[model samples]
Target: MQAHFDAQQRQRSKLTELGLGLSIDIVAALATSAVVAPFVAIIDRSIISNASGRMPLMAGLQDGFRTLATRPAVLARQPSVVAVFSVYAITYITANASETIALSANADPLLPKFLASSTVNIAACVYKDKLLTHWCSLGPARPFPMASYGLFGLRDSLTVAASFSLPPLLSTMLQSNTSMSKTSCDSISQLALPCMVQFISTPIHLLGLDIYNNPSATAVRRAQVVRRDFIPSTLARMGRILPAFGFGGLVNNKTRTTLKRWIL
Candidate 1:
């Protein structure tokens, strides 16, 4: 009787695991579609519009200049907006790449894992290079914005948290072939809940930045003209952070073990 009960419990656990996997697959598909659909529509419209022989390469130049000239003064004063957006962009790219690396590591197709890791490394290198270039270009006359630095720190925290979570979730999911482990199942559930919180926080962050900074024509022109200094600064920041990340990995034997196992 006990053996039968155990078998039944295992069967129920497997069913639950299959259901959860399906749900995750569905959500991932929808999330990707939601992001891609608008991009596709915009690209399609651009292609269709440019297909006409009458399309002038500089047709929008006058309008663009005019829009820039008329931009609000508040935006010019609020450097925090640019800083916040830059930080968010950096964090998002890093977090997503890290997540992809973790998830793809244990995938059945070796190609996916290789591609994901390659892409992430390339992106990180590029961003770090950009950050370094930007920092070097900024002369002594132009001081670093304190508010921007603060915002960047906050964004980094978010990125680190997200990056840390991905490994555990991926490891948990890949642990059991039959998916009967309650701990593994619960990890995925917990991982998903934070993403929902991130979704909610994003709009609030955007709105807050918008309220403080309204885009103006002059600000737009200034942005276009200003040599990006963020790139070099970002690279330097990464140099400091990467060592710490490596140290943490070394200290956490379980994480290191999981990473190595998945990599192989």
Candidate 2:
């Protein structure tokens, strides 16, 4: 029995290991989605409410701005929770679908993700943006500039899409898969590696968001731009991302290990 167990362990190949690794990433992504998005939403609503009241338009716009702000983000002043959640959800689906297509075609996932995120973001913006209400009951009617949404979605969705994207672009050089070992992939220490990558890259992600918000006549650039608070602003974002990534990793690792242990 001891020899058989050892033999079975050795039989696991790197390709199999990669598959397992990808599965963990998916679970972690979903877990982060479920936890972080809601957690940030609550905090976001509170912050936006304190400043602009419970108005959805103001909040969504603020949320959208923050979704694409630079590190030491400028969007903190106009914070909106709904916009953040909307972006997060849309990017999550886009990333998943694009990744599948990339794998099927044996191409780098980044290109597909970039394209899909850039496009679908527009759709998500139109539907998810609560600010533009055609119904007279909400407020004064206004023309929706689909251009701004596309630009905002491009930056926001791209950064978000990059978060889960495994292509290891020049931008994601900071991300390291060194944490996951074939033998200990499910360990807490291993799980923490991906979260650490996410933590390190958080600022980079925000900075990418900041780019499209400026330097153009697009609606995104037209919105009120605030000064980034540096340390405090970054800490606020870290608080949102770190907990979600860490908790998601922990939950998935534990659940998977428990089930496997039981079965074996």
Candidate 3:
């Protein structure tokens, strides 16, 4: 009888911990997304606008802020803004839940964290890419090619690695040799890795957009389009990625850690 009572208590305790952890994730995601989403949306709008040749980059940026300042309601209503918020919110929920579970089980968290976030990131990013590209283009929207999904999935996998996996490893390496403070090491790793990864992922993203916009364009023409927009699009993506993954990831991590200490 005592053994069965103890087992029930253990199960209850586990359930309570999970509930509290999920609550922490919800709070952290809400707080972080509130700040990060608008910035991410603004940059996303600019990048898609430039890629679609709908407007110059600078003009797209100005228009983003101007809309925020003058017509905040409309900015809130934008599909880009809604998508960005959803990604940030869902990412935190999954990442925090996975990390909490791994820690409780005394397992390495890096792989589980990467897997948890990458799955959602790939799906959400593919949808967002196609939606934003179509919305930004002056041309009528068309069905997305199958290749576009694969390209976005690849790009987002890299992003998930940079955001979730590389930072802790890089921070540890930086601390071991550089004598940097842990906070400084973390900041540098979190900021630099995700931004640098944009170099590789941005071209993949642009090529995907080209495929969507010009399905019949030859390989030579698609390559030309990528080359033409490569520099500006890469720079813009680096900017967007820093806010979306770098800064946003930091904010979500800190918030969840703080709340876990307080609540869990």
Candidate 4:
């Protein structure tokens, strides 16, 4: 009778977890969208150009605000919500401020984008990945090298959200009938909002890129640019991200084992 009762409880737990995870995502997105709409709405190129300078900082500010608004999802993982949010909020705003300032100054557009990738990566890997990893979950033990950070921001920016989103998904697939380790489950649950937002924002990011860099370009031209660029670029990014995230389960297992052995 005890065994039978336990089985019923396990079944209910799975259902509850799945339901709660979905709810968290919906709430986080709804909250974040309101925060994002305002910044992205106004605050285009400052008329003074170089006088105002580095205007893309607002994009970074947008990124920071968006990340902060999504804090509800990360509540379980972050040790101190205020500290983590403040760090990432500052990092993102600072980096993007530089990008926008450079753009307004008519500096080469590519340079700011390239340089900002490194810092953005640190924000994602450290703030997003490291901070959120529980006391003994399978997050990487040390900082990835500078080059790796570059690759992370430059190439995998969108997919980090995807990557972070997948482990629990994999966990769910593997043992949907049973409860998962709390640490593992919570981490994945937290990622749901970020993953959905990243995938959904693919087009928006691309559109912003077209308009911001080529200010003189007409709306039709920007639309044409978006059409011409979106497919090939997005596919290329997903192509890189899919394989990496797809292998996430194996990577998690190995890392967890390594950490366990070290602790012993």
Q: By summed lDDT, which 10 consecutive residues of candidate 4 come out lowest? A: 43-52
> Which ranking of candidates, highest TM-score first?
3, 2, 4, 1
Residues 137-191, model 3: lDDT tens digits: 8779988889988998999999889988999999999999997899999999999
lDDT of 2 by residue, 1-264 (tens): 999987787666534644554554455445545555545544334322322223443454465445545432333333233455555555555555566557655787777866775566546544443242222113354454455444444534433443433323422332345544443433343334434454344333333223322334344433322223223334454444444333443454454455435533
Top model number, lDDT: 3
**lDDT tens digits, residues 1-264, model 4?**
999999999888766644543343333323332332232212111111211223333353454346546763543233434333343334334333444455445686344643563455446444443232222123234432343334334334554434443444655664565577755554554434344444444455444443334546787886776575455444433332332233322333344335435532
Model 4: pairs clashing at backbone N, Cα or C within 3 Å: 53-101, 54-100, 54-101, 54-102, 55-100, 55-101, 56-100, 57-96, 57-97
Clashes per prediction? 13, 1, 0, 9
lDDT of 3: 0.86
Query: lDDT by residue for model 1 over 1-264, one digit each (tens)?
Result: 999999999888766644544344333333332332222222212211222212221332333234335753443233322332233233333433444444544544234433443344334433332342233232222333434334333443343443344445555666654455755454443344334334333332222222223223255543432223223223322332332222222233233335445533
How far out, in Å, is residue 108 in model 3? Answer: 1.7
Q: Which segments of candidate 3 are over 4 A away from where they belong?
A: 1-7
* Candidate that beats the other on TM-score, 1 or 3, i.e. the better one: 3
